[model samples]
Target: MNAASQSLSHSSLAYRPDVDGLRAVAIISVVLYHAFPFLLPGGFVGVDVFFVISGFLISSIIFKELEVGRFSFADFYRRRIRRIFPALILVLCVCYAIGWFTLMATDFKMLGKHLAGGMGFAQNIVLYREAGYFDTASELKPLLHLWSLGVEEQFYILFPVIAWGVWRWRGALLPVVLGLGVISFVAGVQKLPSNASAAFYVPQYRFWEILAGSLVAYWSVFHPVAVTRLRQCTALREALALLGFVLMGIALFVIHEARSFPGYWALLPVAGASLLIAAGAESRLNRVLLASRLMVWVGLISYPLYLWHWVVITYIRIIGADALTIVSGTVAIVLSVLLAFLTYRFVELPFRRARSSLPKTAILVSLGAMVAAVGMLSFIKSGLPFRPGLADKVKARETYAQYFENSLPEWAYFSRAGIFDAYRMECDFFDLESYRAGHKSEEPRARIDAGCYVPDTATKVMIWGDSHAQQFYYGLRQVLPDSVSILQVASSGCAANFPGRAQDGKAYCDRSNQFALEVIDKEQPAVLVIAQAYGHDSINSFVELARTARRAGVKRVIVVGPVPHYEPFLYQIVIRKHWNDTPRRIKDNLIQTFSELDERLERKYSDGAGGFEYLSAMRHFCNGEGCLIYLGDDRRTGLVTYDYGHLTPPASLDFAEQALGPRVMANLELQ
Candidate 1:
């Protein structure tokens, strides 16, 4: 083996230990941050470290090959494909199989979509549409880490070609790389706050970090600066390198979820990695630090570890595993290491090494096999069965088509775009059919529904809650008699008891809660409906609000639990269409959780106070087997929610009629 030719051996350049140590820093930061966010809020900067390392390493290889006039994009891409595709394909296959057993149809369909995106190296875009990085459901996505891989892959695809073109023209590589870095960096900074999803997922914003590493490679090749001045202060050079690592570590610990990521603050890790790399091969301390056996092993396994850890954590989180204790995290770490080792040994190393030696026909056959397998599995999990007596698959396809044709109402489009004076609240309010129906005339402004149940006397029925409350508006209007009028002011994602909301420069939740209280006191509504999703925030806060309502002469307070989500509705719809699955069988296990919350609320209000009543849809929504999933089974329109969780206008209206309307009328007679 040529010493200089091997990536990590004593090839043309002696192996740099500090770079491996930098990898150690990067991986550790990511592991710690995900495992324990409170301990090191900024540990996510490790991704920045990895980006620099990758850019430097890949650029170095290409530049060295070009210098020797042996550069081949084909060879480079082949290596990348062998290295990336084998393990990735294995993971996706296993994830898909596991999903069939454990995941709901909605979840399975989502996984299939993600698998398709991962295959095409566009998982980042898929994730951006699904949810924010910090969203509650994010941890449940088994392939979430593929977003970074997608970014890196995108960089690799474009970078080498760009470098080759520039080198061919005899252009100054360093200046060009620097210019690109500056532009990308500016874009990243500008997009971080207002468009965090774009900043996080888009390659344009991430190009700078990669450029930073590329610039280092360009400098190392064309203008190698000897460290003559550092002879007298060799110790100081070691100190500086150590400081760089320490600064990265500190930044990892200090950054947090509330803070925007990969903005200017990301410079810390990138600069730290760059400085340590620049500290050179002769520094004894730096060499020893990076060349430590432990560091080298971790670095060696970093890629596979990065891949496996996310899959494990996602499954664990989806199942509501134990919190990240030291033991659990240690177990996770060990499992990650073991999985990475097995994958590298059996899957990655073998495929990568053997690909070149395999016959062309054999290689093509293998590639074809992988593609066929992916297509087959995607179809199967999407409800397409090819077994004996499988006419059901065809029937399933038919059923799904009939379901969509029947359940979707003409008014649903109006609901999504904001029409008919529908009040819109929440970030995903637009995700609703009502919001898409053109109900919103302005951003962040909600329209109050003109009272279909306008009161005769000045009676107020305040709709106070989160997205669940919004879902009930149509239901209430239909069920509620003309004696009680509802003033619907609901916010999405904001529970009635949410202490405050910081977005839109408004405390909408607090304002709504307080407004409900004030309305109760002023108008003395015979009935008050309090409905919201039963997760996050303290429900005890609502106890206080309930207390305040009773003290303010309110006659009745009703707490409504959230509706059961019937699978991830849209995802299932798409997958069913694509894979010949019946949407009717899509079930949401969360129905039990929703029902339980109502039971808990009923227990809380069982005392004969006569003012507090907990209303539940347990009897109406669910059968003994499970909840009614596909809203009247292909003949119902505007019944099932638009998204996985929020209710549609028709369903909401129906629910209001069933639960709140009659109770309000009975109470009003007493008043």
Candidate 2:
């Protein structure tokens, strides 16, 4: 055997039951967080723990071979394939199969995109582009958890090459690795406040956690006696291990998604995991707790468990089931555990242990071809839209024709330009220069136009606020005469109030709203219309906006009240409750329940002290029976809103005619 092979021989490395136990802890924390976030709010820190463990173990093996000149990149890659591919591919295939039946065309298309990203080990980048970690939309994505795996895979790709180069140069591994970790940690912290999604998903910001483990591995290999001496100091080792446990416990119990993460806060879990690994199995805490048989067994199946849990939970959420309830969550947990065990036993073990008829290179090539084929098929076929029996109930409905006519392909509909198209502001708002510039700014400036509705005429009316304000534009155009010129200065998620963080925690909304107010002053349109989603805090801000508009020589200030909002997205509600049925009136009680916030806002605005006119959207949409989410018997008249709160173009037109047409015409002297 070569010296490198001798150093990496199985006898040279002892099995660490404590590491397996640590794996158990990490997997359990993640599973619980997915199933019941409230139960262990900081359980997501487990991914950080996993990152450290992976860095430690993988680096230890690589460093061993490097020290003795036995490291083969090809061999290392083959081992990675054997370890990661079996369970991951199996899970991906299963998720795709389930998604085929449960998801809508748009959702299925996203599934295809995510599947491709997962197969390519680029899910983190894909998800970063899609939405933030805590976005409601993210809950519906089955492959969202694969982002962490993507980060790890990316790390491994670069780590081995860099480490080998350092070893080849005969440089000290410890200081170089430690310096890299510190740099990564600092970069992550610096970026966390500005580009949180990048900080969370990008490998550079996350490498430190993994490198912390690599540092431990370096010490283990280079200073075995020192490690032994430290482990032998029973009192010191136990104290350190206990302290580490406390830090991790605090992370599991106290950390939450609301806080900026994987930055400075990540140190708690990463350090705790490193301390436990450094203490070794000899420590009382490691021996009694982490190295127990139960933990070891859990650790053994942790990979499959992690793979199975999120998809199940996400599917539950997709189907509109109560994913958080104890009963349903328990069922999901049980199902995940069962599926995990089967996958581990049948898929993982067999593929890992069985000798292949083909060479490792050929086997890897075949696997890569299979993965590529699956991804391509999913993407090109648009997740097999013609899948038999899928959406049969939806297709059977009379509204299906209209739904099909309006529904663009998922990818086309969600493109940056496409989403803005829903508001009919794509041409004006998404100019290439503006779009690129917006990304660089903390508060993206809104693109205001004098002639959205009538380019020939001067600006007669100004519309302001967030997306809610933008939804009224189509309606305003439809109801107003040709002579009326309207200018819309609205930003998504920005409310017309004093500058403050928006609900999405973006400062752009406030900055844009303030800028829009300045434009209204400069333009001095005949009428100023203000609309926003209802929030108690925004009431004062709306009042301020109205006063500012009136002071700016605006003839009128019309404050459009909040519309009824649904729990899940309106489209999801339609798909679940009404997709198979003929057009039916929405129930009054249901409308009342959904519009509870609107009603509260209405009451608050009833006082109307600011000399601003308050108009309730419920007045036009709701009747004695309920609200009109869809109009006409065939449900072809209008879709009230495409999503939970944003109006479709046709619905906006209808709303303009019914709610604001007469009021706006009177104010403009056009009727």
Candidate 3:
């Protein structure tokens, strides 16, 4: 036992402006990363920075109180309420109020669920399961950033009690906390390969980062003499602080969304934060750079700044891509900073300073309860579906359904295969899961049409890929003659890959893709058409998959180019932005984001690689004016796509007849 160290209690500690300065660094990184990921691809690590900071500060307070024999769970939680609730309640209410008008039933429902997650400090768990394909839901959910808070609060719920128990047995707290942190780190590494999203979000996989700071707090508090001696060395202090910055700099520049994060990559930010904190106020760089007036001011508001920026940018994106200009983004950031300052000054300060006849804790708890009530109401009421101006929108949706039912005959491939019901929501956002629990409930029982194989008078045309491929079944039926048999096979989350490992529960994708290849060899279908979600996987991977199909003795392999994708869904876009009584044409700014990629694919593979063809599905759906937004004669009749990128039945038929049919039939007259 370090008996001498126990004498130095919480009374020895003083506020460090450099800590706030470090906070400024973390919050700025996160805000910029969310708004402009490219500029700071690894900026998400800022949250880890916050995690370490929270652990150190929270642990120090608990240890200090425990040493003084004044530690109370009630007091600890009340302090937390004062620290966290004011800004959180305000943000939740604002998002709820705005969403009442802007969000549809489903989106509003998601918002409610997310809001509940936020209020309960379980946002991480909620978001972990709520992920969509490519993890693209981040930009959509306003309170997604609250996931960090969830991890922090969850830690506090467990940590203080554990610390109190361990503190009674002298010197046991450090070993116990350190042992738990090591276990968490090992678990995170194990989970990363099998499921990166799980590693990123789950509390068990994430606690090590917080514990790293907790360890630092323990070291600083209990070994005050040793720490002071170490930091007193001017050269050593500067070098350690600079090394911390270097590690964080590497994380900010080198790591990106493509990287499996919160794995080994997370260590950089955690270590960096630990080093900066351990370096303490005496380090010259920490004093000069981190503790500067501006840095401290920003750090003071970092909490609210973090809360405001995402909601601001997310609402901007929800409005439509046109409004999400660089100028708009800059404005959003500026506005967030302004709001953050006001919140810090008025909302947060009052709560922190106020003493009430009723305890401040009670007021904060009540506010949180009210916010939870709002979220619950939104969820239970299905986003208040009776909001005005939705009659025509509902009618248009109904009309689209009727159009699909009436256009049924050309769906022979799906009818004979009977694969429609199972793979119906592939490439869809609402139905997507990170590692969908229901998918692994059973192995995929794919129903392939016998005509897809068994060579006869019919020349078989097989469509292979994900849901995007299944969508073609509708179009091919309309354009191609009766003699030309179309075979469609697809799986959600498979997205046309060289068969390999997928997220947990998605092992079926590899088997299905391999089955597709085996079918190619066995059936020797005249055409192997690969259609997948747009702007996913690499061009090399797609080209390699096509090459592999050609080697399988498929006479021709047509690699379909990226489709025109829409953000926030085409229907929502129309309902929110273009839902006027008059007919309106929709241009796809989202597709144009991928226009360069589509163009590059066509240019590289257009000339044909061993009877291989590259068909631009995008071109058929777009023109000089813009991408197709409506499938029928007018916008009122039917929109082009139901969700973000999945084609409506009419658009599928239109795209097939106009683009794919002519391309496929050009070289072969098998009939």
Candidate 4:
């Protein structure tokens, strides 16, 4: 081989111990973050470190082959398959098996969806559509970590194609790659504010991290002498390497999920990883610290280690237990390590090294088909509800039919179903399409037409607040006499008290409340009823709303207090109760935890209200015996709450008629 070819061969064939050590750092950080997040808040940045390392290593090999006129796309992909597929497929299959026994139908169905995404290398897209990165729901998803793998695989597929194309036009490669990186980084920063989940997971935003590594590869190839000279500068090399380590430390310690990420904040770790890679093994930090035998050992099994850790942690969480105790967490970590080693030794090594009768392409295609088939089957069967008697358990529950009877259609429950039938006749249901398209402020109000629900001469009762107010409408419609008509001016999550104040940086609530206020001013209804789910500022908002109503010429104002809530979904608790025979006292404790807030809000608002009247829903649903989750002795006939807090349609009607109807009527002098 020529000198350049010899150098390339040495670099590609000879493993850099320090690189493995870096892998150790990345994997450890990620595993720790998953197992004990409080210990290392920014451990998620480890994924970024791996991305950079992948970019550097893969690009170096591809660039070296291109320089020698021996680059083969088939060979590149073959190596990728051997390296990535074995451990991944094994872990996925194991996860499917565990999930079958442990997860609920809804959770299993979601797992099936993720399985399909994992097989297709589209897990990131699937997760992005489902929930945000910081969502509590994400912690329960075993396959969520595969999103990083998906991103890396996407990079592998695209980068080689781009690099090969650029190689043909050698002079343009640098400029094109650098320009794309800059554009991608800029786009990620801009998108973080508006669509953080998309910005975090989408390939376009993440491509820059991989490209940063590719740049180092290009530099190493074209300017070998400069790289050599830089390595010779021991002081500079040590400073750079140490500085990179510090940056990584900052990412692993200071950053958190709450921070806007993969934006400027991402640079800290990405740049650190790039600098460490560029510094070479001769540097003091790399030689003494990163290149240690222990670090290299961990690095060797990092891929499989990462694959096993999350599923173990997620399974523990899925069991509905508290966070893992230190001993339990340690055991989980040990188990993951042991499994990773076994998988690496028996599964990963054999597939990678052994020659078979089938061609590599055929083997890959067959494996892909098997994965797809399994995922499709799981999805089609709705996660095979027959497993562990889930179907039987659900069927045996008395409230099974009752649950569906009062359940709103999916769109309506989600607050996307638009206005009620009463308002639909007056104006198009708040123009949902227009509102979604940024024309929210221009969307017309949902008004109740005169003589729609009552006679033209009847008194008008207008209800306003957030979704809690919307929930009251169902009950009010059932109990209100023919002499009164109801007009609902409510939007999901829109607090009536502070229409203009933004929540979570979204202005949809503000605009919706503004429109509701305008409707109240124009209509001048006889009674304005305000209700909201209790939140931090809810009490203050309730007082302010009452004042605003009196000023707007609404004679009577009624403030409805919040209902009971539970930590987990009430349905999940009910399901658990079926299997565990949970004590009534235990159930009461869970109910009390959520009810305390409701009780406090009621006491403060009802006792000291000035002009308007305050009514408590707790009186009907909760008492000394603990809040009613289900009604009727059969335990299946009536469900008081649809979710943890929201009332079912029947329950809403019952509460309004039995608890609220008399009080509201008396206040309006209609009794």
Candidate 2: tens digits of C-alpha lDDT, residues 434-482? 3332222344535444454334466478787767887888778778877
When 3 and 4 are scored with lDDT, the better candidate is: 3
For each candidate, the alpha-carbon lDDT, in order, equals 0.61, 0.72, 0.73, 0.70
Task: Give the alpha carbon lDDT tens digit for every residue of 7-45 in model 1.
Answer: 343244546666776677677778777777777788788
Q: 1-671, model 4: which lDDT tens digit per residue? A: 00011111234544678888888898899888888889999999998988888777788888888899988999887767766777777888899888876666556766887888887788887766554211225655788888887887888788888889988799888898899889989999987765576688888899899889889888887788999899899888888899899999999998998788979999999999989989998898998988999988888788888889998987875565335668878888999999989997898768766888778666766787698678878776665655564555554442342232221112222342223442222322234444333233322344434432332444778877666777777677778887777776665555575554634333455556676677677676777877776563432466676778778877788777777765445555566543446323234325463366656766676654556676777767777766676655534435565555766666777888887777667667842
- After TM-score superposition, the amount by which residue 543's alpha carbon in candidate 4 deviates from its true location, in angstroms, is 7.7
- What TM value does model 1 have? 0.66
lDDT of 3 by residue, 535-578 (tens): 44462266676677767766777778777777766665665566
RMSD per model, one decimal: 8.6, 5.2, 5.8, 6.1
In candidate 4, position 316 carries an lDDT of 73
lDDT of 4 at 196: 70
Candidate 1 — which residues are off by over 4 angstroms? 1-14, 35-40, 66-70, 132-136, 168-172, 226-236, 281-285, 319-329, 352-356, 359-480, 489-671
Query: Model 2 — which ten-residue stretch has the worst lDDT?
Result: 1-10
